[model samples]
Target: MSKGHDFLITVKAPGKLYIAGEYAVVETGYPAILVALNQFVTVTVEESNDYGTINSQQYKENSLYWKREGNNMVFDNRDNPFHYILSAVHLAESYAQSLNKTMKCYHLNIDSDLDSPDGKKYGLGSSAAVTVATVKALCRFYDLPITNDILFKLSAIAHLDIQGNGSLGDIAASVYGGWIAYRSFDREWLKKARNTFTLNKLISIEWPQLNIELLTPPENLELLIGWTGSPASTSHLVDAVGLEKAEKRSSYQEFLDLSKNCLFKMIDGFHNHSIEIIQKEIRINRELLQHLGKISNVEIETPLLQKLCETAENANGAAKTSGAGGGDCGIVVINKKYATSSLIKEWKKNGICPLNLHVHQIND
Candidate 1:
């Protein structure tokens, strides 16, 4: 293969799931710890005579092209993948400029493991990962003096532009790497705190560790199967909750309080290394999520997911939807004693595959 440029940069950004404190993170100013799953968005940037071209072999066969119009970059949205790529790169350039640096034009290839069906659930923040990866590639390509905080903030801005609303935690986790306690509700307070810690110092801080076992269906434990087939917009879901809050609904307040309690318990479980307690906390967390009305759609909790939850509960395993619910992946914490071959066979019979993800601290 002939090379197109002097340098090629590849960056991978991970997806995230909100284990606890989903709705509350936006309002109560609490920390949400999001796990970066193995699935990632990969970007390849190389110098080109063309202002920019984004190609995703997985999504589309043709390349999406963009040209620089003075200081602005423009793209055509007829091609969805290219539109997203162009938007991401433009944001990256803007981010570079904010750091008192310029971004050079390049041919960028953006790819993601976020395709429907085989891909992880739609709500796992794949778009955020792509934004982070694109920003990192632009930073590297231009040798811009962009810090992790800048990258995170820029990514959040891009996400808001792309999806209308997003939890900044996903972008923060991708840029900062590993586990992070992020609360962006009070930007002024956070902005002041950011001045006190350099990116290098922040990255060097030790994050708490917890043992995560990616369970093999049946051999490890029982799992629930749920598929709504209808894609749910995370922004719409959050908007619904926001309406409840604005209306002064007591249920909304109670759900927020429960989420806070769950967050505390989850943190305690992590700090104390108590798997049993963590499982209990997860159950409470799911219940609170359901009460918030985000998990109300029958499509969100598919018949399969409902069955799996019922089966898992009967088998001493707790199960719930992982992301925004509506037709995404489900999480199950099974008791080691009850994770038997019989349970595995039952799940396979229903076409529900279990992804056992192990949680470990990334020691830099």
Candidate 2:
């Protein structure tokens, strides 16, 4: 444990899910609305003595140390689980210097709620959430001007370094904090357009609140389950898909297009607040992900996951594995009336765990 110092900054970054449009958003430039789930990565920074220390509770055995080199901060990677934090802090320090301010060294303590206490599935956007939190804390610590756009870009850049290939949607949702319609293709265009709209004008904007229910599955749900067992690195997966397309795999192109269409339909459903439409769109999107080679492995679509979907379908609800899908978590949207007792019993009987998530608006 490290002693606290002069200034302390805390930031909470949210997890995200791409409800629609899997692989297509990267190529065709469509907009995807990623919902910010309640799960978060929290970072707390406190200024220490001249020598900076970075302590993280998330990985109990690891810590980070940084030494100021000229105007840059250099760190050793052996003890750090989060190198991106160092990069973000350096960037924040540089930005502070440009504004004629001195950047203070600090001891940082980070704790994450990314994994459930019971050791359940790893949800989507944990890495992105960490990146966002680190950048947010560093900005506050350095007293840098952090606008919504600047925060979004910095988090996205840090995430790209970690995940290799990421749609800026997750970082944007975490930074912006709500149900956001993120168009990476026209992100700059949207930002410029948003600038022209005044608060009075923005007041007329209609953003619908989605009805989201998080559940824990019953033990019987595990009967048909198979764990992909191995974790699929997101960067490697996306790069493989991209290379296939570049090599002129016509099927890959078609899969990408279908994925984009499915995403559009899902967003339209969300905008219209049509649950039936959204359900159908999710099924279509999942199928497209399977076609795109994103969900090919058995671990990606565990037997338990398939059974849950089947059971939900039989019970008038629809479920699918969300996020990067390889042995992480799954999301189910069922009739609100049946979400609690019966469905939960079925899930628990099968040994599947469910998480409770609340969807809320993000403040800029």
Residue 183 error, candidate 2, Å: 2.9
Tens-digit lDDT track of model 1 for 165-254: 545677766666544455544444434544676433432333222112221122332233333344566677767667666666676777
lDDT of 2 by residue, 1-364 (tens): 2334646788888877665555565542655556677778889888866767777666666777776666666676555566666656654565567667765667877777766655434555677777788888887877777776677656654565555565667777787765665656333443453477642232234222211222222222221112223334555556666776766667776776676677667666666666676678767776776666543332345566676666666766656655556555556655454545566667777766555666545554
Q: Which window of ten consecutive residues has the lowest lDDT sum in model 1?
A: 209-218
Query: lDDT per prediction?
Result: 0.61, 0.61
- The clash number for model 1 is 10
TM-score of each candidate structure, all chains considered together: 0.77, 0.79
Q: What's the residue-level lDDT of 97 in candidate 2?
A: 71
Q: Which regions of candidate 1 deviate over 4 angstroms?
A: 1-4, 76-84, 99-102, 116-122, 176-182, 187-231, 294-302, 335-341, 356-364
